[model samples]
Target: MTSPLTRNEQNSKSRAQTFGIRPDLFQAAQDHMVKKSDLDELSENLANAGVRGFTAATLPQNIHLGSPDSGTADYAILPFTDRYGPAVAAHPEPPSLQIEESGLWTVTLNLGTAGHGLAPAGSGFFEVSIYVGPEQPAGGPVRQYDFFNWRVELDHQQSFATTFTVDFVVESPGDFIYVQVSGMRGRAIEGDYTRTRLSVRKTDNRTR
Candidate 1:
């Protein structure tokens, strides 16, 4: 079956006639917006059209960043899976993307409160970077994964959570892609994380 994005692109004019310009343009009028599931499906369709497919790994836990010495925050790799848990029965290793064919992949990182804990002191500016290399960096020169510039800064009092997503293109197989997160605050407002995940969805060259 043709993908919705493909269908939408092909039938833009028809959609415009009914949507008043484009489906996206009507979002505000209709009080709606593009959902993650919609993008996920589109990304999946793009991946299946050329590459093997897409995959996502997540760690359901509360972690901290920019704590103790907030001035010089340390970056932490977002966990993909629980090393010790029932999930290990299904996911033996950390959730990872093993690119079979180099192509663009969408990566999303979401962070939220798990329980009552510290929120940022005032406002928080967090920078999350995606990286790929022979080995995980250890305070050394490392290859920065050049994807969309995905960064999020928010006033802690304004919101309790944030999500950063971007499309990244890879050209080879066996390359490891991961996320590192750091915050501007000296110490992260400590709290339980309600949502924390690193998702990757591959797309076809048509996305170019």
Candidate 2:
């Protein structure tokens, strides 16, 4: 079977008369995805090609950057899993990180999926990265990863905590900051998008 994203892409072409997904148009929005709670949606986005139909990750995650800003969902973006159905991915939705005004802040990713927390508990080829910064096209380095090769193991009913206690300086405040948590599904790697909540506890640039 082909990958969900691949299938979705094909569906877009085959079903162009009915459903049209401009996933490429909203690729920038993916950068905003980030919340440690659940990243199933982000993973699915990589699988599905109907992201434009859904809201892209944005700051103040509570508001979906499109119509229905007052929707009851507390996420900046929703993959609309109910509409398009499930993809062969880790979650029904993508990562939900928050980003309101860029700056140096702390980030903590908690693996909530007990069973398939990503890479099947011991695939031994998973990595996680949190990119922070303003919007970039689809595939540009935003901030950077906390770990070089981070992996998520079987939580066994516990949360896997990976903290990035470092400084992330953005070009401007409220510059569409975000956290990109990506992992590998076997050989094909995908990313989870989320909006990050950034903070600043001002100190000298060099105050060791």
Candidate 3:
């Protein structure tokens, strides 16, 4: 004849069965059987594995181009229309990326444009530049042009459709990244209803 199981033993078995954990291996039975230690371990492992996150922003239609008198280097607010329609017209609030993870992050700047016919037939030229800096204030001096920048050019012969791209790495957390469009000339950008986009994300070199 076998003796019936005690109340404590019954509850332990019940919790283990419900949680799909072995009763013999499940040690935390009192004051909640779910182990906090196990959860903490899982989270730590995930962080060490280098989980990645990213965000993207698109140029707004009819972006304010600084007057030609101000020159391309002058400060001009480039509005951005989010993935959807509406518009993010607020100043200093243009699309930006807030880094939270410390790893190798990449920023890809893309611009698409069409000839504005500003120049004579077969004589047009379009130029645009992207600038990036670390935690740069809304209005900072252009003397710090060394952060990172790239310029794309299209002449009458190459004016149909143009896309420019630039890639670089960010190695610290709490670092903020933004874009500035400059050195634009010749024809206007193509996306009037929509506009170019900038994307920032993390990448693991070991996996490459």
On lDDT, the candidate that comes out on top is 1
What is the C-alpha RMSD, rounded to one decimal, of candidate 2? 28.1
- Candidate 2 lDDT, tens digit per residue, 4-78? 667666667755543454555444445575655457776775554332111122122221111222312121222
| Candidates, ranked, lDDT | 1, 3, 2
Cα lDDT for residue 15, candidate 2: 52
Instruction: Please identify model 1 stretches exceeding 4 Å from their true place.
Output: 1-52, 68-72, 82-96, 113-120, 138-141, 145-149, 156-158, 184-194, 205-208
TM-score, ranked from best to worst = 1, 3, 2
TM-score of each: 0.53, 0.30, 0.51
lDDT of 3 at 86: 24
What overall lDDT goes with each candidate model?
0.53, 0.32, 0.50
lDDT of 3 by residue, 1-208 (tens): 9999997778776775657654544554544655789899999977756625566666656443334444332334344435432222111235455555555656665665554433334442233445545554466423322355455555533544444555545454555556555533334544443346665666543322
Error of 1 at 3 (Å): 62
Q: For model 1, what is the alpha-carbon lDDT of residue 19? A: 54
Overlapping backbone residue pairs in candidate 1 total: 11
Q: List the residue pairs that clash in candidate 3.
A: none
Q: What TM-score, to 2 decimals, does candidate 1 have?
A: 0.53
Candidate 3 global TM-score: 0.51
